[model samples]
Target chain A: MDILGDLLLGVQTAFSFWNLTYCLLGVFLGTAIGVLPGLGPTATVAMLLPVTFGLSPETAIIMLAGIFYGAQYGGSTTAILVNLPGESSSVVTAIDGYQMARQGQAGKALATAAIGSFIAGSIATVLIAFFAPLLSSVALAFGPHEYFALMVLGLAASVVLASGSLLHAVGMILFGLILGLIGTDVQTGAMRFTFGSFELADGISFVVVAMGVFGLGEILSNLENESDRTTVLTKVTGLMPTRADLRAMLAPVGRGTALGSVLGILPGGGAMLSSFASYALEKKVSKNPQQFGKGALAGVAGPEAANNAGAQTSFIPMLTLGIPSNPVMALMIGALIMQGIQPGPSVVQDQPVLFWGLIVSMWIGNLMLLVLNLPLIGIWVKMISIPYGYLFPCIVAFCLIGVFSLANSTFDIWLMGLFGVAGYILRKLDCEPAPLLLGFVLGPMLEEHLRRAMLVSRGDVTSFVTSPISAVLLLVAAALIASVLAPAIRSKREEAFQDED
Target chain B: MQGHRTKDFWAGAIYLVLGLATVILARDLTLGSAARMGPGYFPTVLGGLLAIIGLVSLLRGLLRPGELVERIHMKPMILVIGATLFFAIALDFLGLAVALPAAMFITATASKRFRLAPVPLLGLVAFTIFCVLVFVRGLDVPLPMFGTLFGG
Candidate 1:
C-alpha cells in the first residue's frame, strides 16, 4: 500500500509536462550521440553534464539517467546495422546482431534488441523500486568502519574486473587517490597539494578529469591511425520479428535480465561486464552453441537485454549507498553533489520525490526508447557515416567550453588537456582508466571513513575486522584480490575479455 | 633500447616517479598519529603502496616478455592537446567567438582527412554561431562573445 502511494507520487512528478519534455530530450540527445561511433555513455554524459546545470535537480538527474540507459539502446542499433559497436557495452551485440544484419535480418535484430531492452528495463526498474529502499535501510546502519570496508571492497572488485594488468590497475587506483588529495584537508584546514593555488584548494573537479580522460583522451585515440571507416550498410526490412523468433528470444531475455540485475548491483559491475557475462552464459546454456557467433536470435536477445538491465540497475549502489559502481555513476554522484544533495541512505528518506521520480523516469525513458528507436533506425544508420574529421573537433570544442563553464576558469580546461595526454599515454600502456576514475571519486570518502573509524577505535586497526559487517566486507575484498592474483583465474579472466579485443 | 622496452616498464617508471613525488611532497604536512591523522597520512601510505607496486611492475617488465609499447603517434596527440591549451588561453583574451573557431580549425587539422577547403571552414563557422547561441544566449554561460581585449 505504501509502495503504491509512493508509486502514485512518482507518477505525478515524472508525468509533469517539463519533466516529460526533459526526459524526452535526454533520451533523444543520448541516442543521437550514442549512435555515433567512438563515443560511449561515459563520454556522452560527461560532455553533456554542463548542459544540465541550468535545470532543476530532479529534472537534471532524470535527464542524465535517461542518457545513461538510452545510450544502451542506441548502441545496439549501430552494432546491428553497421557491425560497429557505438558503445563498449554493445560489443557483444555486434557479434550476432551484425551477423544477422549481413544475413538480411537487420530489422529483426533491431526489433529483438528493442523488445529485449524494453522488457529488461521494465523489470529492472521495478526491481530498483523494491530493492533500493531495502538496501538503503541496511546501509543506514553502516558505521565508518563498515563504510571504509565497503569502499575497500568496491575498489578491490574494480581492480579485479578491470580488463588489463592487475598491477597497473592498482597503481592507477593509488594514482587517483593521490589526485584526490590535492585539496584542502577537511579536518585540519591544511592544503596538502594545492601548490599555493586557490583553484587547487577545492581540488580537481571530477568533471574536468572525466572530460579530459574520457572525452579528449578518447578523441586522441580515435584520431590515431585514422583509416576511413567502411560501413557495409545493410538494408532493414520487416521491422517486426516473427512469432518463432519471439519465442526463441523469451527464455534468454528472462535469464539475461535475471543475471544482469544481480550483477549490476555489485560494485564495479555494469553494462559492459553484464553483456559480456550474458554472452558467455548464453553460449554455455544454448543447445546449439555454434550458432552463437553466426546470428543466433538468442545471442542478440541475451546481451542486449542484459546490458539494458545492467545499465538500469547499476543505479542502485549509487542511489542507495553513495558508492559508484562505475564512472558514469561517479559522474551521477558529482551531479547530485552539484545539486547540493549528499547521496546516501538519507536520500531515500529525505528526498523521496527525487528517489522515486528517478526510478519511475527510467521505466518511462525505456518505453520512449522502444517507441522512438524503431522508427529512427534509419537516421542512426546515417549518423554513423559522419566523418571522424568533423566529429572530433566538435568534441574538442565542447570539452573546452564545458570544462570552462564549470567554474568559468581556464585552469580546469588546462587540467583537462593535461589529463587527456595522460589518458592517451596510459591507454597505450594497456592501463584502463575506468578504475582510476572510480578511485578518484572514492578516494576522499575512503580516506575520511578510514580516519574516522580509526579515531573511533582509538587508532586500533582491529576495529575494522572486529565489526561483523566490516569483517565480512573486508573478507570479500581480500577474496576478490586473491582471486585476481591466482594464476588460473587470471588467465580465465583474460579469456572472458578476449572477445573485446 | 637494449633490454625489454615493454609498456609495463614505462608505466612502472612513471608510477614510481609519481609515487615518490607524492611521498616527498607530503613530508611537509604533519603525518600525526593514526588516531588523529593529519593531512599527510593517507597520501603517504597510498604513495608508498604505489611505489611498491611500481617496483614490482618494473621488475616484471624486465623479467617477462610482455607486450611492447606501441609506437607513439605524435601528430594527433600533439595537435589535439595543443589546440585545447590554445582554447584555454584564447578564451580569456580572444573570447569564444575567436577562440572556438580557431581551436576547431586546429583540431580539424589533427585529422588526416582534414583539408584547407571552404566547406569545412563554413561548417566550423556555422558551428561556432550555434555554440554561441546555445551556450551563451540560451544557457547563459558567462562567456563573452568578444573578450575584454575587444573593449566590449
Candidate 2:
C-alpha cells in the first residue's frame, strides 16, 4: 500500500471528534504526569489502563499513545527547569539542560527541546507510515518456525541489554515465562496448571500484572523514601530560542533523528538507550566537546529529538510483528489484547481504521504536544510540586478500583496485591521488570510456535535449523547470548591470571 | 549489608522450586512425539530449562560477589500491600465507599509526609468521591455504596 493512501485512511479516523478529543486528552494528561517527579508515562499508563476499558480500541489506543508523547516532551521540562530528569531518557537532557537553567537560558533550552522533538517526530512518523506496511508484508511471509526463532532472539536481546546482572535478567525472563504458562493448553483445551480454581483456568490478566507491577509496586517503592517536594526551579525569564540557537541545533536534530529511527527498530532498543546513544554521539562529534556539560544547544536538542523519534519508531515492531521492544511497548501490546484485537501482521488487514488511525494520531499527538506544552509551561512546572503523599494514595486508590473493574471480581485485586509484593521483591533483587514483561507477553506465543513448527516438520527436530530464515534467527539469538557471555568469561580469565601473579 | 549473593541464592532457590513444581505438575500430561506434541511437551521442556538456569544461577551466586541488597521498608510493605488486600476482602462486605477510603487512608498514612492534617484528610476523601463518581456512577462498575454486610 502507498504511504499516502494509508495516511489518508488514518486521517479520516484520526480527525473524528471523539478520536481528536481523546488524542488531545491523552497527550495533555501524559504531559501532565510526565512533568511530575517519580511518575512517568509507564506508571501513568499502567494506572490509567482501566479507564480505557469502556472505549473502542481505536479511541483507547489514541489516548494512551497521546500520554506517551506528552510524557516524553514533559520529561524535558523537568530536566531543564529542575536539573532532574523525570524519566531516564531525559537524564542526558538534564546534564546540559539544567546547566542552561542555571545560566538563565532555561527558556532557550526548553524551546529547543520542544522544536527538535517535533521535527524528529514528524520525520519518524513519516518513516513509520512508509515502512510499517512493507514490514507487515514481510512478517506475513514468516512461518511459525521463524516467528518462534524471532521471539527467542528478542527475549535474549532484551536480557543482554537489560539494566541488571545477566543472571538476574535471565532469572526474571524464566520466571515470567513460568507465569505465562499458568493457564489451560490452547491445543487440547486441557487445564495445564490451573490447579482447582476457575480463575486459574484462563490464567492471569496482563492488566492485573502490569498495574500491580508498574503501578502498585512503584507506589510501594516510592512511599519508602521521604521526599521534600519543594519546587527547585525559581523563575523563567525567557521562553524562546534565538536564531543562533536554532542554527546550532539543526545538525544534531537531523543526526539524532536518523540514529534513533534506526536503533528504535532493533530488538531491545528504544527511547532510553536511543537518547543516551545520541548524547554520546553528539559529544564525540562536537567541535567543542568541552562545552558538553555547559549548556550546548546540541546537547538538549539531540537527545530530545532522538528520544521522541525512538519512541515513535518503537511502535513499528509492536504494530507489525506483535513483539514489544520494551516495557512501554509491552503495555501497548497488552492494551491491544484487551481491546480484543490480536496483535500481529493482520492488525493492519483486520482493523485498518484502528491501525492507521493510531499511526496518524501519533503524529497529531506530537503536534498537539508542541502546541499545548509550549504555551502552558508555567502550569506544567507547578505540577512538579504535587506531593507524593497525595499521589501515592491516589494511585493506590486507582489501582484498586481499576483492577476491581476488570471482570468485577475482587479476586483480581488480591492477585494484584500478590504481584505487588512480587514486583517489589524483584526490584529489590535488581532484576529488571522490563524483560520479565516481554517474556510474559511472548511466552504463550513462543510455546505455540515451537510446537506448531515441530508438528509441521513431522517430528524432525532439525527442521528449525534447515529453514533458512529460522536458522538465521536462531543464529542471531545464539550470537546475542555469546556476546553477553564473552565479556564475563574474559573478565574471569583476567581475574585468574591476576590471582596467579 | 550482606552482598546480593544471599539474595541471588534465594532467588535461584525460588526459581528452582518453581521449575520443579512445573515439571511435577506436567508429568502426568502426555508428552507426545515431536510431530504431534501433547500439551505437556513444551512446558516440560521449559520447566527443565528453568531448573538448569536456576542451578547455574545458584552456583554463580556462590562464586561471584555482587551488590548489596536494598534495605526493606516494612512500614509501607505491610501497610500498602496490606491495605490493598484489606480493600479486596472488604469491598464485597463493606462496599466501595468504605473499602476504598480505608485502603487510601492506610496507604496515605504510610507516606513519610503524611500527617493527620485536614488537607490530606480532605484530599483522601475527595479522591474517593471522585473515583466513586467516575467508576461507580459514570462507568457503572457495579460497586455498591454499602454492602450486604451493612444490611443496606
Candidate 3:
C-alpha cells in the first residue's frame, strides 16, 4: 500500500477511543515524568512495561511510543524553566532555554520548543512512514552472515558512540552478552548459565533487568545527592514568539530536524546525541556565536527540534531491522517480543496496523504534547518542586509492584534488588548500562546468526568478509573503532561529550 | 596502592572476576568446533574477550592516572534495596495491603529530608490505595490484596 493509504489506516486505528485515550495518557504521563527532574523515560517505560501486557499490541506500542517522544517535549519545559534538564536529551536545551526563562522570556522559550518539536516530530514521522518499509524490504534480503555482521556493527557503533571509557563500554557489552547466556540453550536444550535455578531456566526477563538497573538504580543514585531544586519563573508571560524570534528559529529547526533524523538512524545515536550535535551546529553557523550560551533562540529551537526528531526516527531501526538504536528502543523491542511478535523485516508486513498506527500516533502524541506543554506549563513547573523525598518512595513502590506482577514472584524482586546494587556500583565505576542493555537484547540474536553463518559456510570464517554487504558492514565497524582509538579523534570525541559532565 | 583506589581498577577487577568465572563455569559444556558451534562456543569466546578487556583496563588503571571511585553512600543504596526486598518477603505473608505501605515507609527513609510529616503520611496512604485500586481491582494482576497468611 501507498504511504498515504497506510497512514490513513493508522489514523483509523489510532483515533479509536481506547487508542486515543491511552495515547493521551501516555503523553500526559510522559510529560509529567519528563518535567520531574531525575526521572527518565527509560525507567518510566521499564516500570510501566508490565502494565501494557493487558492491552492490544497496537495500543500498547502507541502508548509506549507516545511516552518516548512526549518526553522530548516535556524535557524542554523543565530545561527552560528550572535550568535542570529533566531528561539527558534536554541537557543542551537548558543552556539557552534556562537563560531565556531567567530573562523573563520563559513563555517565548517554551513556545519555541513546543513549535520546533512539533514540526520536527511531524517531519520525522513522515520520514519513518516513507523509509521504514524500504529499509525493511532491504533487511529481508539479509542472510545469517549479513545479520551477524550487522549486529557486530551495531554493537561496535554503540560502544564507540557511548560516552566513557571504550574498554569499559566493551566490557559492559560482553558482560551483557554473558548475562544473556544464562538460560536453556535453544538449539541443544542444555542449560548454559542457570546455575541450577529453575526460575532462570527461561532466562531473565528484560523488564526485570531494566527495572532493576534503570529504575531502582536511578532512584538510588538520585537519593545520593538530594539537592534542592529552585524554579526560576513563577509565572510565564508571553505565550507566543515574535516574528523576529520565529525567523531566527526557522532555519535552525529545519537544520536540526535534518541532522537529528540522520543521526537517529545510526546505532547508539538518538535524542541525546542529536541535541548535542544540533547545539554545536547552531553555534558554528550562527552569525553571532557569542549569544549562544546567553539566550540564543536558535540554541533552544535547534536542540529541542533535534531531540524530538531524533527520538522519533530512532524507532526506524527497531521497527524495521529489529536492531535497537538506543535503550528505549531496546525496551520497545522487548515489549514486542513479549507480545509474541518477532521484531524484524517481516514486522512491517505482518503487523502493518502496529507499525503504521505507532507512526501515526507519534504525530498525534506530538500534537498532544504541544497543547499539553504550552497551556499547562504551570503544572509542570509546580511538579519540579515536588520533593524527591515523597517521589522516591512512590517510585520504589511502583517498581516493586511492577516487577512482582511479572509472574507474582518475589524472586524477580530480589533479582531486581541485586541488579540495583550492581547498577549503582557500575555507575560509580563509570561504566554505562545503556550499551549493556542493548547488548543483552542483541546477544541471543548475535550468537544465533554467528552460529548459523558458520554452519552455512562449513566453518569458514572468511564467509563474513566474502559477502560484500557483510564485508562493508564489518569495515564500517572497524573504521568506527579505529576512529575512536586514534589519538586525534579520541581527544575530539572527549571534547564533544565534555559539556555533558 | 593508590592505583588500587581508582574506579577503573575496581571496575576492571569486577569484570575480570565475572569473565573468568564465566569461562570456568562453561568448561563443562561441550565446546564444539567452529563448523558446529556448541552452546559453550559463544560464551567462552565472549568470556575470553571480556577477560582480556578487563585485564587491559586493570593494567591501564594501575599504570596511568585515572578517576577515583566516588564515595559510596550506604544509607540510600541499602535502604532502597532493603525496601524492595522487604516488599518481596512481606508480600506473600502480609500482602499488598501491608507490604506496599511498609515498603514505601522504608524507602522514604532513604532521603535525608525524610520526616514523619502528615503530607508524606497521607501520600503513602493515598498511593497504596491507588495501587490496590489500579493493579488489583482494575487490572486484576492476580496479586492478592491480602496474602495467604492473611487468608486473602
Report the lDDT tens digits of candidate 3 across residue range A300-382: 99999999999999999999999999999999999999999999999998998998889888888988998999888888888
The pairs that clash in candidate 2 are none
For each candidate, what is chain B's TM-score?
0.93, 0.89, 0.95
Alpha-carbon lDDT of model 3: 0.91
Candidate 3, B-chain TM: 0.95
- Model 2 over residues B14-85: C-alpha lDDT tens digits? 678878988999898888878898988878887887888788877766777745567877788899999999
In terms of lDDT, the best-performing candidate is 3
Chain B alone, TM-score, model 2: 0.89
lDDT of 2 by residue, A342-421 (tens): 99998877888988999899889998999877877888878877777777788788888888887789889889999889
What's the CA error at residue A342 for candidate 1, in Å? 0.5
What alpha-carbon RMSD in Å does predicted model 2 have with respect to the real structure? 3.5
Task: Summing lDDT over every window of 10 consecutive residues in candidate 2 chain B, give the lowest-scoring window.
Answer: B1-10
What does the TM-score come to for chain B in model 1?
0.93
Weakest lDDT window of 10 consecutive positions for candidate 1 chain A: A226-235
What is model 3's C-alpha RMSD? 1.1
Model 3 steric clash pairs: none
